[model samples]
Target: MAELWKSLPSWVRNIVVPVLVLVLAWNIVTFVFGVVGALLAMLVKLLVVVGIAAAVVILVKKAAKS
Candidate 1:
């Protein structure tokens, strides 16, 4: 491995390697953001359902008291 690396030109070693690393890092970050966005969307859906349920319960209770 060391011998192979040493055989490569200096420009390739410096430029190509860093560009590959940056691309890989960007892909990883994009995947993480996608997962977080999905989770947040699910949470918002749950909150909306809970809010609607609470409103129905309150209305029912008020009607019963009347």
Candidate 2:
């Protein structure tokens, strides 16, 4: 592997390889951010559902007291 890299032209070794590495890193970061965003969205939706359920229970109890 080292021999093959050493044989490559200077422009490819310096520019192309670095650009490819950067692209790979960028793609990985984007994928991680997408996963996190989806998880957060699900959490927000779950909280909203729980809040609605609690509100309904409270209202029912208040009505019973009246």
Candidate 3:
């Protein structure tokens, strides 16, 4: 595999890599973002819930410490 890749010309590799990356990125932008965006939104909501929980914990801790 390494020898096969090494046999290819540098220009070929350069062109192929950029094209593949562009296609993969375009698909992700067009398709994967929907699922990933939903997951990210859920993550943000979870973080908010965690933040509120932490604040309550901190207030309780401070009250006890005082």
Candidate with top lDDT is 2
TM-score for each model: 0.78, 0.84, 0.49
Q: Model 2 lDDT vs. the true structure?
A: 1.00
Worst 10 residues of 2 by lDDT: 5-14
Which candidate has the top score in TM-score? 2
Q: Candidate 3: what lDDT?
A: 0.93
Candidate rank order under lDDT: 2, 1, 3
lDDT of 2 by residue, 19-46 (tens): 9999999999999999999999999999
Per-residue lDDT of 66 in model 1: 100
| Backbone clashes, each candidate | 0, 0, 0
* lDDT tens digits by residue: candidate 1, 1-66: 999999999998999999999999999999999999999999999999999999999999999999
* lDDT value, residue 8 of candidate 3: 90
Which residue pairs collide in model 3, if any? Answer: none
- Residue pairs with clashing backbones, model 1: none
Model 3 TM-score on a 0 to 1 scale = 0.49
Off by over 4 Å in 2: none
How much lDDT does each candidate structure score? 0.99, 1.00, 0.93
